[model samples]
Target chain A: MTDTVHSDSAPPNGALPGTGDENVTGDEKMWTARVRRAAMRTLPPDKLLPDRQPSYVASWIYVFGVLTIAALVVIIASGVVLTWKGPSWWHVSKVGLFFNSIHLWSVELFFFFMVIHLWGKFFMAAWRGRRRATWVTGVVCFVVSIGAAFTGYISQQNFDSQWIATQAKDGLNSVGIGAFFNVLNFGQMLLWHVLLLPAVVIAFVGLHILLVRRRGVVHPFPARARPARHRITGAATVPDEALPSSEIETVLHKDPEPVR
Target chain B: MIDVVSASIVNLTHPGHYLHWGFIQLSLANSIVILAMLAVFVLALVLPFRSGRRSRR
Candidate 1:
């Protein structure tokens, strides 16, 4: 690879480098460079982590996503401690039980905040303005989180878990994924609960957030919140005095296009 | 053994505080949670947020 780097750095035709050896334009010779270029193109530092959010972001509805993320952080942290102590320790040890309780409530609040966020975004048409991918990812993450939480239930190492697993096994088998995802197996379920599902959830969540930052939050319905216009006679389209105070504030604090 | 925290108000472990509508039967706790979530969602939409700070941009 090193030998080809200098030789193939500048190919005759400037084809995309990742498209195989056929397109090794000067900068694309190295995979690192290609990756760097792609990352820079897709998520320049500002887009990936912008310092300023659009003014429309100032809403309690907007905070739910952040709250959901916060709950997930607590869930993961408490889950780590619970895993370190092992499952049965929670039944006998106070500290383990405390962490276990924290994990449970955090999971509940996570779902709670996430569902509210989903509702808020749905009513607002979050898929608007080329954000369908972000919307889809958020929905997929919700489904994956359900799976993660289900596994946590049946992996709890109690009669409750046992009953849940027993009842769930037949339904899973009917779907033909039982062998692949055996709910009755405590160890398997625990591993999945702590490892596999969390990884998928986190990865999808990261993608969802990056897409949000990339495309920007969806705007309000165009009809409902059109920018106040001005007429040729120097009169306002919607008189400033006629509008409600709150609506006026929303209109006056216009923001730059988030899609940029 | 009992949970003082949850049982103090009502015996949460005992079932029967539920709403039954046709084929749908939901526990009071779940119904309350769903109602609370809906309420919060509405409040988030309607409440005035603190946007007093001017945009630095």
Candidate 2:
């Protein structure tokens, strides 16, 4: 049997692609119209449905994530400076020393807020719905982040760096990982730390944000149903906004009445 | 022959530093910080799934 391919490059049934006519004779015409509409809806007033705003926005605890991202930006800028001079310059030159200091401080700040961001997200229980993939991706990123930081620390030509590299290898070898990752290999470790690991981390972070935007933030806990007596009594019900702040206390000391 | 040569090369180049006590202290501190961060990261990742499942339950 011979196969006949339909090639209708022109608008079908004399209908323009934008018109989205049912009688559009070609598959391309149909798909083009749909895709166009999708693109259009993704822009401005006729946009795709708006997702719900996070319920935790007012809390100061949320600031750590933004701070972590800010520190990462600094890290990237300082890293670019070091990359321009090459790794060896930082050990000798004054300008290099300044940039190195800035990079070190940036890493410290990044780790500080990153830890906070991770913890805050966890306690907030932000990973609800079909969000396990986001969580898993984030976990993988965390592992990668550790590797990046390790390689980064060793890449510094300081006494600390030299000592750590030699010492850490023993532990790694005992665990059977040293066969693949030789900490003493400066060239390989430098590239992996500075370029490869950061690239992977950034990619994971991008995916995490996309998934979050798609799914929307989880709501705070539902209101507790009061007992008839409590409703009758002067015992006022706590507001939903107080949920996250008081979660620790509430978990530690069970309320005499059921929470929900 | 190769093993003997490589061993000799190592002996000549070696700095002969045992994992110094200072380095051990630094590593321990770093490991604690890193471990805490790891726990937090795992918790953050797992939170969504846990809440999702909890709601279903």
Candidate 3:
């Protein structure tokens, strides 16, 4: 398929019309319309789910973010099945046992892919070009995911869960949140694992993605382009933003220790 | 259905070596998971993406 859209080439903060922090308007005073207008201006449909991305975005490192989301989908789907089956049902029934294992492995993959995505973004300085909120939301999602995983472990109706809860409660108590987030109580931990934490993670992940869409992917670092020693001595090459996809790929492939 | 926990019996035959330092501790299996993530991350950066050409209009 032909690439339908050109990238939001310039830094989205300045280039996109009416996309700046203040997009003033009048006569649409009704709260709902005002919000709708604001949303449309900030993120038009095309941008909210763009068909085209910059050439720099095609690297394998970018795939981890989608992998993390895919793993979360499996985790949520399997968790729903496991929850519907009830806690003790898995111990005896084959189908329930299979779903439980699926849920468990999906959580493992979620964290595994999430950490890799984080590492890639960190090395790329993903917060650049007015994208700090995007990066912060991703960090919050990671932290909330850890909390969800902890609650999941402590919610299990097994010896391991009991051991973890009994050991964890003391540390939580010292922090003074043990009363509210009581690890020792299976009902509370299960509620958090299955509901509250997941909701927060999903919401934050959604917001993080929206922010990324609003601001295009961070531009490649200027430092990555080196002087072509043979082409013209002492004349530094231009940044990747101006290059076509093929040339950009060549630059990326020839990167001398791209991750600093 | 096989017990997921019982799957560990395969590894139990070769008891895992573990490392501990300060408040951090990890079995060989856990260490391998971390090291594998790092390896994958490095490979992701170095490996060429086929879709690079597709970025062109």
Candidate 4:
């Protein structure tokens, strides 16, 4: 309930009482100590896993956010299996083929839900309430995911991969970036697809979700049923002077409820 | 016996050779990918978002 820990309740100088670490150091300069403090302040456990949410958050439009996360989990699980078995295994083994299919389908779902989420946020003006970082990070994640998908197509080691690489190389060369991003290089593409791009994507996704947790969900648009207007000294105005005042008060006082 | 087993396993594992749809031609692998994508789209459309009692705080 309280933001600051009281000195009277502070644990013994050399141990973290609540953490159950008997040999903990109380040094302020410790890197792990600083990180823990920062994480606790920025993303408290209650915010990370909420039990209730604003009433307006129950809309169908919000579902795509969780759907995208679900698809990402499936993609990562299948990707791990693919990495363990290697590229050629999928083409030869039924088990590998099944996993490969799961990966492909999951990617498709991920993009589908992600696009819907992006559009929903755009229409909702999700950057309102100083949440620009959340919106920007989400957009960056989407852009990087495209690169991940491109590298994946090139690393498939099949006819489609061969054709895509050959076709993409010319485009890359025309832009004069082919010297660095050689689409024809299978090994390079494989590394980017499996390791580099995914890392970047995961990092951005983590930041995006963290920002969302910090900012809470944006409120729904105010109700549009305006009161009837009447002529007031040659100027038409709504009769209720308290409406805008009430709206401002609601916006100022409302806190986001925990997610259900 | 080894030959028969190998043939049967290949038949089970191999995605068909080609898929022709009027103006379109796709390898079996590509066809499978396309089918999977379609299935995902359908799932997105039909999947329910809410479960149990839908009370709000």
The prediction achieving the highest TM-score against the true structure is: 1
Candidates ranked by DockQ = 1, 3, 4, 2
B1-57: candidate 4 lDDT, tens digit per residue: 644776876675545698789998888866776676556545645666563355454
**DockQ class, candidate 4:** incorrect
The collision pairs in model 2 are A127-B48, A128-B48
Please provide TM-scores, in order, for all candidate models, with all chains considered together: 0.79, 0.60, 0.77, 0.70
Tell me candidate 4's interface RMSD. 5.3
List the lowest-lDDT window of 10 residues for candidate 3 chain A: A227-236
* Clash pairs (backbone) in predicted model 4: A52-A258, A52-A259
* Superposed Cα RMSD, model 2: 13.5
Error of 1 at A70 (Å): 0.5
Native-contact recovery for every candidate? 0.53, 0.06, 0.50, 0.03
Question: Candidate 1 — which residues are off by over 4 angstroms?
Answer: A1-28, A224-260, B1-3, B10-13
Candidate 2 — which residues are off by over 4 angstroms?
A1-55, A229-260, B1-57
Tens digit of per-residue lDDT, candidate 4, span A26-55: 454467666766777788878887776655
Docking quality class, candidate 1: acceptable
Q: List model 1 lDDT by residue over A157-236, tens digit each.
A: 98889999999999999999999999988889989999999999999989999999898887655334334643221223
Runs in model 3 deviating more than 4 A are A1-29, A224-260, B1-9, B12-16, B21-24, B52-57
Give me the overall lDDT of model 1: 0.79
Position A175, candidate 3: lDDT: 96
**Collision count for each candidate, in order:** 1, 2, 0, 2
lDDT of each: 0.79, 0.65, 0.77, 0.75
Higher-ranked by DockQ: 3 or 4: 3
